[model samples]
Target: MPPPPRRRGSSRGKILDLIRTTGPISRVELAEMTGLTQATISTSVRELLRDGLVSETGRGESTGGKPRTSLEINPAARLGIGLHIGRDYTTYIVADLAGTVVGRLRVAGVGDSEPESAITRMAEDIEQLLDGLDVDRGAIVGVGIATPGPLDRDAGAIMGAPALGAWTGFPLAATLSEATGFTCTFDNDATAAAIGEFWLGATGGYNTYASVYMGAGIGVGIVIDGTIYHGKQANVGELGHITVDAMGPTCACGNVGCVELYAGPQAVIDAAHEAVEHGELDMEFTGRITADFDRIADLALNGDATASAIFARSAEYLAAGIVSMVNLIDVQLVVLAGSAFQTIGSLYARTIAQRLGERAFARAVQTVDVRMSVNGTDAAALGAATLVLQDRLSPRSLASITLA
Candidate 1:
């Protein structure tokens, strides 16, 4: 067998990332942006070109001499998979090297089911999706799984999470890899969404920012200098668990008056059900959290006072938590993502942005930009896939080996 290729340095990954984000770019431009020497950028980009990971799109305007050849990512050169496991639904996405989602699927979540059984079923779904797409298996980099967490990533295990307690200490990465015949990496959904946004250059070039993801729960993902900040135990962002009400009820995570207790999707759904029971809302709901949440949003949009009050209260609490986060981290950008925000994102966005504009400690010095994720409900799933792409194609360090 031929000897494995020598692994290149971090510079290669850095250059590739820049190309994907701001491509049809010249080698000179890369050198300028990265502050790497012209010689170094040439060497790294040459290796990327040789490996079929990058392509020279064409020439650009000449500065003084010969026209410069612009380079861009070869989107077809590689593929990645992202599996987002949420409270009520699971999503799968396939993205090419340029961070564009090529295929997607959604299915029932791990609600009241055995964690092991759920993983097995997801694995089969992945195989079938790939087969249906007729994707070149050899081009597949790997899979990244995003789940609600308070987990141990190095051990590839979930320590524990509410409603997902049965998955505690489960070897999620190993089990998924075993079932799918592909390498797997696991992380919390919020962090994955942040990475996905960063991978797609959605942060408007800010090196530090936070993604406030609302799904079954609320969580924050912090990225500083272009990397996810996995504070001790790889569980840094728990924005939902932050105490928003000192006199409120306790949460499953043992916190008092968490923002999620008042603002999460489940909270909204429960409140809607209570309103219906009390004859406040003259409507029937199917009890599915997402569907019910959407219905409430529609009613609110259509001028239902009760529904508007429910979401407004939720938005108020969520914005308060986010304002606190901004006060603490001072990030200039806060992105709203995940399934919960898919329908009522505008409400949350306006509230959060207003709170930040008015209350953030840095409000005088900087305006924190808050926007909805373009990926919508697919944000976490796409980010999960981006985890694989970033790891394999543009990792910050030398670790992964070239695929055979």
Candidate 2:
């Protein structure tokens, strides 16, 4: 068997990162940006060019004398794969060095299947995707997996994700790595979303922010001091399970009146179904009412009294949850994200903003900024891909820190 690849940091890696982030620059500019000497930058660029990872794109216009050669990262030199493991489906995307997705594959409903079987299928799907693309295998750096929490990051296993029953204690990262022969990394879906927003969305400059991910369940990803806080055991941000009403409804986590029980998509659909069943409305909703929730939002937006009441109640619970979070963390910004938030996000944003203004303990000091996630359907997946990028480029050791 082939020996494991050597793991060593090199000047070429840092140079590649700099070029990928800010390219079309001269070696002198790179030296200035990286604090490396001009001779070192030229040496690293030569190695990168030899490896086909970078190239001299063109000559920069001369400022004083002869035009300097502009160095740029070869977008085709490397690829990163991002996989978002949702409750119902997995989304796979191949992104270039520039963070642009050039190829994609969607795998639907593998959550109910056995873990090994699902992983095997996922591996096959990835192979198929790679087979179809013209990208070189050597250029593929690694894969990133975004799964629902709570997860054991050290073990790379899913603990007890309700949406993915077959994934309990599954060694997802190792399985993918063994199957594909590539380095693999794992992160919580919500945290991945926040990183995605920072890396590719509008939250780059925001220091303290919260990414409220509303999917099969609600999860909040906190960014304090420009870094994601993954508290003890990678299970810190369980915003969905935050208690909103002591006597409300029972949640899947065996808690009563959790925020998710009131504001999650399932809860909204259940309310609508109950309303329909009790002759209060005439909309039939049986299984997985994603579309039905949108129908309720439309009705509320269109001035239907009953639907408006239901949405308002849900929004109230959502606001209460956000207010509680704000009082605890005092973050300046909150970004609403997830597939469910795509349609009715404005209603949630308005409710959360108003409640934060009125009731948060920090209201006297500062106002919490609530906004929608800039990346719509692809936030989680894109964030997952960014895990690979961060693992490779970012200075901090995300794996070593214990979140609060």
Candidate 3:
């Protein structure tokens, strides 16, 4: 919490950022990279070194000149904590300054506990994690919480959720802060995944894309030119509620035939179990929704008719949803990441690509790219960590620009 050396409007930010991306670089190389004079680069490097954010790696061979000192980011100088609260389990990760996940821990979820009790347990776990890792408390920049949403992020409260409404109207971030003694921030899981992708994963250089987060439910986080779009109260991208089948079942959101009713892994598992009960499905899958779906998807890939049809039905509905989404938003890229996508992701991706090719409004003029996240099931948690980084280094006041 100590005041960071003047960041905004300071050449040090730019210089430090460049060194991180293009390092073991020399002062001359940094100057060449930033178009800053050698003296300006020296001044910024001095500030960065004094702040302990940058360190000199051993000297490197020169290009027909004297050996030069190499510069690099001091990743271990600080840490960020990211937590993902979900129905299956909760994940907590600690990332260093350079976005490396240096440690992680998972524990039983809230179960039937109330929101206050659940958050209290999470706080304890975070304390244990830090203590076990022996991380300096001052080195922890802050904590970021990612959870299922319809959140009032600005107010740091949960609005609604799927089976998900245990904490509506609770001041989550503030309450957690009071308990843990660390500043806490919150974002819907889908949006957190997008920010994670923006900061530490694939979409770092890309300005616009959509990340579809499928866990117990489905949601999309939209980023345009490096800024996540948060409509009036941060309830913006509830993509699962889109009606893909007008004649399908009614949804809890008071909508008929919403895509999640068919494509959410829980929905598909329910459908699969129903098929099993009727003896239409040759195999039975039971366990966590994600595991059951993974088994079912494996059967489908192995050419079982029932399993294939089950995933196909889900994929068709998902395709309908994605096509509708791409048609409306026109983002050239859509990234699939979450616990659900860990299995059957390729099926969804292939089907979605095919759907976009055939049904997207501008298919003839443009192509939409569907990708799987490299961050995998950890995307939300990792992105949650990225939120702490973003808040500390790249404030919204510097919008529409690359984050630090």
Over 298-334, each residue of candidate 1 has an lDDT whose tens digit, in order, gives: 8888999999999999999999999999888889899
Residue-by-residue lDDT tens digits, candidate 2, 1-404: 98444344455666776676677888888888778888888888888799777789899889998899998878777778888887566788887777778788876747467888888888888899889998888878788888778899888998888787678887899998998888898888888888777765466456788898887788988888755787656687889899988888787788888998888888888888788888886665536545577778788788877788888888899889888988898798999888778887888899999999999997898878888988776778877776786575433456432111
For candidate 3, lDDT tens digit of each residue in 1-404?
Answer: 87334324346666766776667899998888778899999998998898788899989876788889999988887788999988777899998777788878888766557988888898999988887886677778889899887788768887767655777788889999999998887788898888787666476545678999988889898887656776655676788899977888889888998999988888888888888899888775656666687788888888888888888888888888888887777787899999878877898899998989999999999788889988889989988886776566544321232443
Name the top lDDT candidate. 1
What TM-score fits each model? 0.92, 0.84, 0.86
**Model 1 misplacement above 4 A:** 1-9, 395-404
Misplaced by over 4 Å in model 3 are 1-17, 25-45, 58-70, 246-248, 282-287, 397-401
**Candidate 3 residue-wise lDDT at 278:** 91
lDDT scores in order: 0.84, 0.79, 0.80
lDDT of 3 at 404: 32
Residue 122 of model 3, lDDT score: 88
Shift of residue 130 alpha carbon in model 3, Å: 2.0
| Pairs in steric clash, model 3 | none
Winner by TM-score between candidate 3 and candidate 2: 3
